[model samples]
Target: MASSLTKDSSGIPGSEKTFFGHPRGLATLFMTEMWERFSFYGMRALLPLYLVSGGTAAAGGSQGGGLAMTAATATAIYSIYLAMVYLLAMPGGWFGDRVWGPRRTVAISASVIMLGHLTLALPGQGAFFAGLALVALGSGLLKANISTMVGHLYDGPDDPRRDGGFTVFYMGINLGAFAAPLVIGTVGQQVGWHLGFALAAVGMGLGLVQFLYGTRHLNPRSGLVPEPLTREERNRVLRRTVLVVLAAAVFYGVVVVAGLYTMNWALVPITVAGLLIPVAVLVRIKRDRELSDGEQSRMTGYIWFFAAAAVFWMIYDQGGSTLAIFAADKTDTSVFGWSFPASWFQSVNPVLIMALAPLLAWIWLYLARRAKEPSTVVKFAAGLALVGLSFFLFILPLSAAGGGKVGPLWLVGIYLLQTVGELCLSPVGLSVTTKMAPAKYASQMLGVWFLAVTAGDCVTGLLSLAGVDLNTTGVVALEAAVAALAGIGVYAYRGKVRTLMGRVH
Candidate 1:
């Protein structure tokens, strides 16, 4: 079974070449992810703005634009969509490891995502909703497995180059992220939303082509199913997967027929599931008698880091939803007597990420050389604090304006701080998850890390519902306080958790 899952190196030429002192496969994966993120973030930047846009002639309607959704409704749907995108990664990862392998899974996922964007480019509310569902599912399948493939490129877990490779991979993500909003956002907000959606489809199509061509250059094990199943096991898994999909479809049909298909209804169950799944997984892991004491200790410390990451994402992810709204409604976006699309502001964080990622990577390497690097726990705490401060910075401009538009610099400042926070935490979390995870549960732990983003998104949705109408300053201040307190609490306990992490560093 293991032999079937792994390919021999004799079949491929130039597979061992180094790119920038790392595996040549890194270049292929990098560009694949870059274009993938271009499509994903491009669509995301437009979703909120598109939702709130009025469709009626009297409401200043555009051709094939908006569903006349209220802010609460738009945000609710946005939150649910983002939550599902992350939450589904667990099942997606399992499917790859057990059934298909990363290469096939990513190929299928990219195709589906392109189809989703094309569907959105068509006219109708049905198409819009359908597109969103496809994109969410496809994204879930692609995101985790690609990262896993990156890990497989290394020779072993202790490889010093692993962290730097991830940083480079992360920069590809931001590079695409940085460009999408400026291009797609402008087209969607100014030219036409459907055109923008079509552009995203084009982006994914290009990525899929790149991925297909680059497959031969990757490691022979890059797409191999980790545990090849027996014939009977494969049949059983296929049957169960089909049944689950059918059941979900039936349930959704019933809800739609019963007039109970509101976004809030969907959000309620999804949010609860997102919060509970990780806890349930942790509880089960704790009960497993097979794990070593060291493994158990690392898992326990991981929970704390996971919680801190959740808080950071909950605050940071506001850039797409609430912050987008604020930019459209409250920020002065005029430059040289011309107003830009609100979605364009979404580009700022990624642009900053691209600029700062190398600097952060150098800083980490420098600190490591000097034996002065901060522990993972400390970095996580510091990230949370920076995110909190970013929110708090909004208070002055918001307070002074008193329901009026503020300068664009205010939002830029907020994004700058938040980007710094992201630099501190996000990549570190990915690197450390690989380091500390037990061999048997490595992929599962990575899925749980994604669930932190899912849970955070759920909280963002709920917060939007409760505080959407509150003064902007008050909302920002309240969120800031919660994050600040959480950061402080984490910092206080960082020492003990570091000890619990054993030799993970």
Candidate 2:
């Protein structure tokens, strides 16, 4: 798998691939990632709380409250946005391959995101929804491209320092994620929504500037022009067939949007048709096998991680949903005679992620010296267990408080625990897939990686629909089931998974 890489003529990343007392360009990428993450998480932190409630009371919500959206719609909308963000990686990847290279894509996408945030800062109803669509589109381009750049920073898939590099990069992401809620959420909640969203816009603008300044450290385009199509490649039947399929998709989307279709209509038909349509087309290609052997192996790994990732996200991503609402209504947010806003509780996870990622990396390094470090499956299993335990931990305080007001510490403790679990699993998954996937299907495997996230989030959407006014027993049970299922899958794939990963060095 590593053999496919070709070094730049200068032959860097030689025996010693170090720069600025670290792996080459690590800090450059770090700052770039930091601003990018700040924009992303800042936007995300505001989304659920904003949508479910609207703006803070200081902004435009009821009595300094938020928009007051139903939990079901908020959760559904969140899931759809996240799902679309990842799914659009397909188009993002293609664009990176075709028109704008990764650097240009990153800059342009971030700029679009900046515009979206600016739009949100405006008061017009049309601008409000349009801003959201813009954010989704912009995120679609940026999310995948930034990660691809991380991969581009290295030459070979199996670079020994790859894990550490991703960990470092992961820290950049969480740093942004950490600051967003605290900074923007605080302003919106304390000041007003317009001011808060404007802060988010500024954050994204910072990212764009950082990306542009750091472009020189980046790799140039690969110049992979698509090969010309021949007679069979230009088949009229296939073109017409694709057109028909698209038209059908458009019609289906309109029905679903209009509420003429059933609730699960989007989920069921999309899942079924999406799965079948691919296999049907791929069946023809399977004969010629454009996919390499490594591609096949990488594809296999992608599915397992994707499934596992889905479950992980279903539980972790709830910080903004079930947990956020819990903080607002139920927690004793008072500290030193001052009451804090509820959405601030969401800040704990990103904070913890940034703090723990390096600690976990160091701990793993220490363990590796004695051969005590866990494998990826083991790490993933531990993550699932931590999540399960976190929920279990919450049961105590929640029940004790009678689901009423409790100390902010309780929420902080839970988010901290959740962040530890995230550090154990989330960052490494990127490097793992990058190393495992075949060269030909790299981006697609990444897309498939997103599917796991989509599935997990889809489940979250369903679970989030359950009324929290109830015991939340349903949500807890659902997460537990998901955790167990993910754990079992990890165990089943342990051997082959390890082999595909090769030695972690």
Candidate 3:
């Protein structure tokens, strides 16, 4: 069995040959995640626009191709969908750790995600909702495990290439993200929404195929469950898994039957789950007798980082919801007399990340060599502050436009700032989680880290419900002010957080 394979006496597998000075497995994981991100972001770019579009045949008319939802409703749905995607990571990671292992879990996830996109290409609201559910579930399974696998590629905590490898892997994510909006967004907006969705399905199919073909290159350890269950325990777990799935199905059915399948009703439960799960996980970690005091303190620091991350994402993720609407309705898409699709704006951040990732990776390594690297908490503070400033930047263009369409450059500038923020915080967050989490619950703790994103998405949903117009100056300023305050608050506590982190930074 591949899972039983081990390194030769030289401590290297035949397939462990270097790629860009890292293991060959990095290339495989990189391309796999790239395609997955392409599929995910491609589909997402179309969602808000599609929801509000009318299913009419009028060119550029809002009346012919969408569900005809209001901006608030559509934004709310988008936020909830994103929230669920991260929220389910908890169980998905647990399943990988306790049952399927990362390799199998990732494969299953890609397959389901592909199927979900295909289903969305079909007609009817029923298909739409079902497809969203499947995609969310699949994303939950894939997201944390892939990152965990990247960490597994390194032999030890002290591996010098670990951070660089993650940065490279993150670039793959952006590569896919960069292409999705250009390709899928154009197809969905101009060719037809269904065709765009079909393209996304194709992207996932390619990813799964590539991953299956390249599995041999990965470390064999990645394929085995961390702690396999006993035969009796496996049977019990199987039964419980079935029951949980069935119960979820019944709940959705009841919601539909009760005519409560709207955004407002859905937000209530999702928000509660998003907020409570991380808190519960933190409490569990604190009470675990197996952890040393140092580990506990590190976990406490992680929780603080998690809170700041949630705040950062609450502002950053508006790119798909509020920002998407703004691009479609308020921004000038014309450049050199050519009008671009609104969804293409979604590509900006990824494009920037792809361009900047290598530089940032080098910078971090350079700083480390000089013994001047910023602590993880400091990076978190910088990221939050940058994102807050990005929001503030929008105020300038909003004021200048004064109810007229603003130049696309304004959005470009905003994305540029936000990309810097993402670079500082996101990859760092993943690395820190792996370093700090207890060995027995590594993958689950990663899931807990992602719950910060879940919380952000839920909060975004509520914020969207306020119905703030992107073209309005007062609302834009208010958003900028609030984000700035949050960023400042996090930075102010950097000293205390650094103390908690101890030697992990």
Candidate 4:
């Protein structure tokens, strides 16, 4: 498993320890991810704002106008789209582990992502939905496999630099994110939405090109299928996939024919499936005879981490939907007598991340040197608490505003706090997933890790359908309380989780 999962130091590009004293492959992955995130966050920043613009020229021009969707409808679509993107990572991981190797899978998936963004550049409602589906499919395939390849650049399971390496990679993601809104968001909100989408397409195209050019730097083992399926197993999987597709087609056909199809109704199954897949994955891992008792026990501890992540993302990801709305409609975006785009607020978190990730990385390394580093569980708790506190900060502003707009600093502060929380959890979660993964199901475990995000987005969608008023002080307070309590709960149980984790930490 370790052989498949990590490269020998000899495999590093020229073994010179370039790219911030890590493997040279890290630079290639970092840039590729940067552009992919540029495309993704560029489109994402505008999606909610566009959806709720209600096609009114007052919001933007007629050319730049949106689908005229109600707030609930927009929220539902946004949540479902995000949920699907993460949800697909599970099957994407399976394909990487069994069919295509991680390197090949990434290359193929990136091409698909470029095509998706191109489709989005076209006009019409049909094109919009189709393009979204393509992007989600491609992103699902690309996400986990690429991260697995990153893990492959390291020397061993317990490599001290693993967490810092991921943090650097995460910085690339934020760099792209920081630039997207200023470019794509401004164009989408001012010039035209399709033009912005076209720019996003260009970003993905650049990413694909860079990735292809840099493949030589990646670990050669990333191209090897760790556990190839037999002919019989392949045939069985093919048969099941076809059957599932057909079943889905027939079900949707029936719903459309029966006049029972609506956006909200369409989302119910996705939300339900998103919530259930993680549980099913955990259950399957627990019952797998291939795993030893120690592995299963580690998985038992992982359940707690998984739940904590789901809770964190549930609040954190709302920055796109709920918070974006708050920014546009209720928060003043003026600075130095120049009004900024609401979508530009999307850039704030990424900018903060770019500034702070290196410092946090240094702090982690520094703490580790003294054998006084906090456990992963404690970091997760701190992250959860900080994000909750960000929301808690919103209460005073919203309550004091009394239906009027508040200052921009309020949102900036919220994003700053969430940024800190993300630093604590997101990259650490990625590093830990590689460390604890079972050998046979290594990439799939990464997929399961992303299911935590899927579950969070599913609940976000469900909350929208339930008509929770996101702007209400009461709702904000409740969300803050849930996150804070979850953080405290995990901190209290840190000892038990460490025990279950066996030797991993």
Candidate 5:
């Protein structure tokens, strides 16, 4: 199976390469990611408004979607959804590594996500909530494993095209992110949110078909079936599954009680318990010998990077939450005598990502040549700092609004800065996983990385509760706290992180 999944470091699961400058396998994965992201972000762009829009107020609190939810409620729901998706990525990663492999996992996930989108597009309340759940689970699975398959594209540790391939791969993700909001969000605003959900369903369907069609080029190294497990391996898998299920239960409870949409405050205890289990796992890993010395060190560094980056994400992903609402509710969007819908502003970040990704790739390449390239830790800190700067940009127009509308250009500017910060941090973090993680534990570590983003997203939900009428000082204060906390964490962990990184070429 491994031999069949292997490619000549250019194509997909079972094929050879050609003159297109990339493996044939990468093409399908590329479209798969693109459409997956399109489905995810397309729904994402409209979710805040759907929750806050007047037609659906009963399920939401007086401050949330069905009601005239304060911007904070919308932000809270957005952040929660984002967090859950990332958190589920852990299970998704494990399922791929232990059971399905990346290809099947991605395929199944895409199908599931399509179903979720269909549910969201249905004509009633119960379907919408249920659809959201399917979407979260599907995304968690796909987001974790798709990149794992990409890593499989390279046969060994020293493939030169791996970095470039990842860059191109991430570009696919951004391309989807870029297009989904414009297409789906605009349609949602025009026809109804249901239309946007339907579009997302179509997008996921497209991604699924693309994946099925391109199986010939898949990397031959995928779908590694484990031999029948011994007692220890079997026990370990069983234990981990139990822990994961328990943790997910708890976290869902907390998120539900806190969210206006899935108002299930009844689960707070479960959420608290869920939050603690992962920390306990880390503690066990620190004292356990299941990992090699190198594995131990890498896992330790991952924990910090995961946590620190989560802080960055909490602040960074606000683009979809607080910032989305801000654009919708308060931004002055008229242009050429046509007032632009706030949903359109979601396009700004992807555009900036498209623009900045190349420069970041070049900057890293230039630095690598000069032997002056920053370590992953350094780059991550810079990401945190850059996102911090982006948040400050909001203060100016937010303050100037003074209970009046702020110009949409200001929101555009903020997204540009945020997109640059994401370019610096988000995709690079994916690269860091492949670089630092040992093959034996790669998928697990990827899961950890995603979990961190999920944790940060959870915090974003809680923090979004801080205010709806956020003024310039309030926005500044919020951002400053995030920046300072992230900066301090990064600095304190600097030495350990470098030591774990070893000498990279």
Candidate 6:
């Protein structure tokens, strides 16, 4: 049986070669992730604009096409939704490691995600929030497992193809992300909101179909448990799960009965959990006696990398929130006598990523052969600084426009800088996380990696509560300084971090 196959073996038994000289399974995983991202980014592109469109509030809703939420409320919901998506990845990874395995978990979660999008296609505010919750749950479950499956495709830790493979995979992500806004955004903004949501549902359905069909190409190990729980452990987990569910039900009933159910009230616990989970995970890893002293040391350095990533995403993710708002309200939509949808601007970063990722991948490979490749720490520092610079550059157009609409090229330039920064950090971080992970906690470690994003997104949501316009000069300046300072700090201490990392790089 394929489940008995060795993890190091590539794909489809003897027919291992295909898909750009990589494993055939990569093509399958690639397309699956592509369609999933199409659904994800499609909804993201439309969400902010839809929230404020009609200027009505169901709980707070739109005109004919939106929920009509205030800008602050919509931004908070967007950030919270993003946070929850990554936040649930922790348990998702645990389930993959101990219960269902990555392949099964991915399949199950993808089905749930399709349902979420479909729910969003339904009319009414209740359906909207329900759909977001469903998507968050399913996406969180699907994301870490799928990426872990990709890592499983390579031979081992030292395989030269691992980083390159991840880069190719990252490109698939951008290909989907690039197209989503153009298609989904246009429809959502111009047609009906629910129709745009239905398109997202179709994309996810397509992804699931292809994923199921292509499972044969994947390693059989993907379907087998890496660390199955003992009977005693399983019983304990079941009891705890039941208790948690009951508690949640009780809380929901109490809130509904008391007439105290508000969206912000619901967000509070989620926000708190997002802030706490990464720290809890780190503490758990630190306390684990199974790891060697060297492994523990590497984790110390990983903390620094984690912090840098959180800061990067805190700013970078604004492309769909604050920056999207800026594009809609303050940027000139006309180019060459044509006015475009503001959501179309969201496509800029992915398009840049699609164009540049291959070039960066080749450059990294070239540098590695010559022993001149930058350390992961160096790359991270560069990424932080570049993102900071992107925000800082926004000051120029802000000054020139004097509160009037700026040309679209200004956004293009900003996205260009941010895209390069993402290349420096994101794919590199994924590869490094896989390499540095302790064997017993492989999938869980990836979950922890996603927690960086969760932390950043949670902070983004909290910032909305401060009532600061994210597009203002003061806000932009502060953001730029923080990232720049972090980059400088990381660069200054790279030597020490390298020592902690030992030989991993």
What are the per-model C-alpha RMSD values against the true structure? 5.1, 6.2, 4.5, 4.4, 5.7, 4.5
Error of 2 at 304 (Å): 3.3
TM-score of each: 0.89, 0.78, 0.88, 0.89, 0.83, 0.90
Q: Where is model 5 more than 4 Å wrong at Cα?
A: 1-19, 55-68, 220-262, 266-274, 290-302, 434-440, 464-472, 488-505
lDDT by residue (tens digit), candidate 1, 120-236: 998788899999989999999998888888988887778777877887788889889989999999998889988999999999999999999988877777678888789999899
Clashing pairs in 2: 53-66, 53-67, 53-68, 54-66, 54-67, 57-64, 57-65, 306-452, 332-406
Candidate 5 weakest lDDT stretch, 10 residues? 56-65
TM-score, predicted candidate 4 vs. hidden true structure: 0.89
Q: What ranges in model 6 sit over 4 Å off?
A: 1-17, 56-64, 151-165, 365-372, 399-403
Clashing pairs in 3: 54-62, 54-63, 54-64, 54-65, 55-64, 55-65, 56-63, 56-64
User: What pairs collide in candidate 6?
Assistant: 54-63, 57-60, 57-61, 58-61, 61-67, 61-68, 62-66, 62-67, 62-68
lDDT value for candidate 5? 0.73
Better of 4 and 5 by TM-score: 4
Candidate 6 per-residue lDDT, tens place, 1-505, comes to 1232233335444444466656778888999999999999999998888777776322112235577776777777888899899889888888898999999999999999999999999988999999999999999899889988997888886877776777678888989999999999888877888999999999999999999999998989899989899999999999999999999999899999999897767777788788898888898897899999888988888999999999999999887887787777678888999977888998998888878977997899999999999999999999999999999998877667664778999989989999999999997898789788877777567778888999998888888755656767888899999999999999999999999989888
Q: Go through the candidates in order and give each one's C-alpha lDDT.
A: 0.82, 0.66, 0.83, 0.85, 0.73, 0.86
Question: Looking at model 6, which ten-residue stretch has the lowest summed lDDT?
Answer: 1-10
Q: Report clashes for each candidate as comma-separated counts.
A: 0, 9, 8, 1, 26, 9
CA deviation > 4 Å runs, candidate 2: 1-29, 54-65, 124-126, 150-168, 214-217, 222-302, 464-471, 492-505
The digit string of per-residue lDDT tens for model 2 on 1-505 reads: 1221233224453544343334345555677678766766776766766765643211222233445566555666666567667667766776766557767777788888899899988875567667877887888887777777776776667765565567668777777777777888888767777678888889888777766776666655322223333567558646987999999889888998887986456544433443343344333333437766655555555556656777787777777766776666567777899866666676677766666766887999999999998888888877777776677667766676663567888878777777887777776676576666666655565665665566666666654444343126555665666686677768777888766555431
* Model 1, runs deviating above 4 Å: 1-23, 55-64, 157-164, 246-260, 368-370, 465-471
